[model samples]
Target chain A: MIDPIDLQLIVAIQEGLPIVARPYKIIAGQLDLEEQEIIERLSRLKQQGLIKRLGVIVKHRRLGYQSNAMVVFDMPDKLVKQKGEQISQLAFINLCYLRPRRGELWPYNLFCMIHGKSRELVLQQLTQLIDSCALNDYPYDILFSTRCFKQRGAIYSIDK
Target chain B: MLSILHKQLLNNFQQEFPLSPRPFQDIANILGVSEDEVLSAYRELDKLQFISRIGPVIQPNYIGLSTLIAMQVPGEQLSAVASIVNHFPEVNHNYEREHLFNLWFVLIADDEHHLQTVITGIEGKTGIKTMQLPLLEDYFINLGFQLDLEDNHQSESVCT
Candidate 1:
């Protein structure tokens, strides 16, 4: 579990780091802590795997990655780990996960996201992924994102 | 229409963004550009919504609980249901996809109870059943995407 100060620090910068020469210094000032302390804490968090990534969060759609498809597969339970790892290694696959199936309503247990410049490119990549992985037998579906109602960094309430 | 400097910053600095007193200056030194140039480029990127932010991508279920949820809202009520779902601060990403379960979102909360509360609240408000698909295993360690800016085919549709 993270301490209170660390939680506060995470909350402070979770939204974003100020786009300035000394962003850390700005965060330090906000928390009334030394700049070095803020840096060290963040470094420690990253090391602990609490912070998965620390960097530029690009808006892919605006960067010409217009096709966003969430590809899910209903794989045999045992094959999920192997197949998920294999699919995650592909350069075009942005996100991959193993999720639980909810009976017949949701039969997919594996999910991956592919973002590309166009629908054709995304489809080609999906085809390549399927052929290379030998996933012909597994039932799969590609749900292309039509609209983004909202998108933002997660907000953590300290009160919890 | 991204400048060379902008492309370099977007592609290379997605991960390992400097954690120092003058982080932008560090990036500037590496890119062979002035600190002000890097800062302004990033400022413009943020202004144009090309980059969302420079911050830590917290690991799921690390600081708080999170789940991927899907709901099948009728086409007519899609916008209204989305508005209700977007009302909660916990709901970070809400998207309309092409599927039976057309509306999908991600919710993060301080704990399991809070997460469930938000889910239940949304169900009550929208009157649509939600299928929670929390992460059983994450196959990829997010290193950030390495963008290929050479073939820049910007989409005609504006995503707002």
Candidate 2:
């Protein structure tokens, strides 16, 4: 747990960091502290792993490229970690994970995000990447992102 | 002067709230604090990394577009290509996952043509081909992290 003063500082960072010249400076003024204090507290928070990163968010669908998919693989249990690392190294894969595999319904254990300009290009790379991995030895399926009902950032309200 | 109650007041804002002209007053009533107190605390929380942004997630498909693109960038060049992908505001969330495709990032644009232009731009800059995989269908849900309970595995073996 943190004291109220530090907690207040955290609250400000979470609510919204201003986007302007010297954003931290503006935040420091709002908190009635020096810029150095805001920077120090944020650095500590980041080091502690409470704060992941601070940056702008882009609305993807509104932009274009409008197709997104999650490709899952039924990777051998032995190769989970190694294979996950390999996939993560791909510049195109934004999200990658190793979920516990279920039965035939959810047989995929490895997941990666793939995006492209056209459907043809997306599939072409998919085939090539799989072929390179000799992934034919394993079973997989691609789950596309059809709709995004509610997508938001993390909430830090649990003080109990 | 201030204590845990203040923490509760700030976190509650990030979660669920009824937006009205006098939102601060309403929150003050619930937390048993003065309206000015709630407002002041809010300004403080904004200084910390506790909250990223406070706004409705605008739809992506409305104006421009986006795709969950994937690319298998060379490990040595992953960071370089990622920076290229992120140069445009079109890119939203990017991550290094555990898979063959090492780099993953979301690209949003004003239209399909723009998405393509961005992809081409990235390809030219990095000299690495991009695979844009758009989702076909989505089943099984939940995006936001659960706060009320422990990490209860859904579908018993679903991916994160």
Candidate 3:
């Protein structure tokens, strides 16, 4: 459980982490604690695997990359584990997962995403993988992202 | 103060930052700037992204509540479909990845059943099958990024 002080520190960090000489130090200053305390808390959180990362969020569309596709492949239940592993290993796969197919309304079993500079390039890569897997026999669909509403990381707090 | 070069360095921080102490300094050294500058630059970047970040991008499972809902929309009913999905604020993420199940969104419902009920309700109203994939397990890192870039998931983990 987070005490009030920790919660306050968390709130400030959630609002924004400082950017400079020593970020934790700056955060600590805001929270009225020592930098070491902030660092120590983060370390503990890391050990518990609560906090995930500290990094940058880059804008992709503005960078002029052309295409993105949601490639759904129909792999047999038996081969799903093997194929999913293989797909996940590829460098270009930003996101990949397998979901059970629904009633006739939907029939695709596995879903994976491949990204590249353009739709053509992404499609070319998709063709190679689809053909190589001989996955044409199974039913599937491809839906490219038309819009994005929220793409930032999920913010969390102890209070529900 | 951050120089233009340091800002450029933040542009290159990427999804996976190399693990090291004085990590920002390491970046500064590579970019020909002082550690202080790199530190400050990170703050500015965090402010822009609306979260604190650095190291260990936590898997979605770590914070709990995750599900994927895919709905097939009649070509003409797309707007209505989106409005229905948008009704629930828990639908933190809505996307248009390429596929026949054209509309995909992440629903952070109170639980798995809640996620299913919403999808089912949508399907009942629209008559198209809605595939609800409650994340079974997470081993693959799937997050959309940009041209030659993967989005940085390092937001502050108020995971306490």
Candidate 4:
């Protein structure tokens, strides 16, 4: 079970941390706790796998990476494990995972999300990835996002 | 294109941001800049949505059930359907993609039963067929993109 202060910490940083030297100290002051306490709680939260990693989230679109595609592959179950690992190692692939196939309508099991400056570049990279990774035989489709309705870090407000 | 300092911040902090109480101070010291400078720069970056947030990115499927869902909505009802999906607390990311299955969203629920219930509820409300793609195997995720700050160009600021 998470303590109240821990939940408070998550809520506070849900949007972001303040851009200050002593960010935790400032948060501690607001929460009426010592700086060390905030640091310790955060560390524990991370260790417990509740918090994955603390880092910067660069907006890819803002960095001229406007073209993004979700590539789904119809991979045989036997080869998925081996191929998924290889695909994930490729430099341009940001997210690569395997999802369950949904019968005839959706036959894809392996999925990857790739981003580039333009659609042509993204497709070029995908073609190269397919050839280099020997993934040419697999049937796949790419879905390019037209608009982002909402995007944010997961909220842990739901009772665990 | 980004300024030298902005580039430095993105390059350094994207992966291994300091976990210290005075992390900004550490960054300032590393860049030979004042704490205020680092603070204000980050503030501007956040305001501009250059970075979504500076914190821990939770590992999906670790805490709750999550799935990628896609729906085919008429173009005229796109906004309305998107708003409906956005209203769900379980949804973290939602988007409109250029495909027959246009609207896509990621939903996180406490368990499989809950996930199914939510999917059913969404289908009933939207009167659209929904496709569920649950993760079967994850090979890689949360990879940060490295930007070449040499261009020194940024998108035109959108006045709020």
Cα-based lDDT at residue B79, candidate 3: 71
CAPRI quality of model 2: incorrect
Give each model's whole-structure lDDT. 0.90, 0.55, 0.61, 0.81
Candidate 3 CAPRI classification by DockQ: acceptable
Chain A TM-score from candidate 2? 0.78
Report the lDDT tens digits of candidate 3 across residue range A1-160: 4456655655566534444545677777777888778777766654565544445554344334435677876778888877777777666676778777776766767888765667787888887777766666777677777666445445545445
lDDT, candidate 1, B6-108, per-residue tens: 9988888877988788989999999899999999999998888888889988888878899999999999999999999998989978999999999999999
Which candidate model has the greater TM-score, 3 or 4?
A: 4
The digit string of per-residue lDDT tens for model 2 on B9-69 reads: 5335543332333445777798888777766665554443233354322223422456666
Best by lDDT: 1
Q: Candidate 2, residues A26-132: lDDT per residue as tens digits?
A: 77788899887777776665455444333323223322334566778888878877767766655455556655554544466677766654467567767876876
lDDT of 4 by residue, A72-133 (tens): 88998999988888888888898888888888878889989888777998999899889988
Q: After superposition, how far is residue B3 of candidate 4 from its true place, in Å?
A: 1.2
When sorted by TM-score, best at the front, the candidate numbers are 1, 4, 3, 2
| Candidate 4 lDDT for residue A80 | 91
- The fnat of each candidate, in order, is 0.84, 0.02, 0.35, 0.74
Predicted candidate 1 versus true structure: per-residue lDDT over A98-126, tens digit per residue: 99999998899999999998899999999
Query: Which lDDT tens digits does candidate 4 get at residues B83-142?
Result: 888888888679888888899999988789989988988988888889988877678855
Q: Could you tell me how far off, in angstroms, the CA of residue A77 lies in candidate 3 after the best superposition?
A: 2.4
TM-score evaluated only on chain B, model 3: 0.56
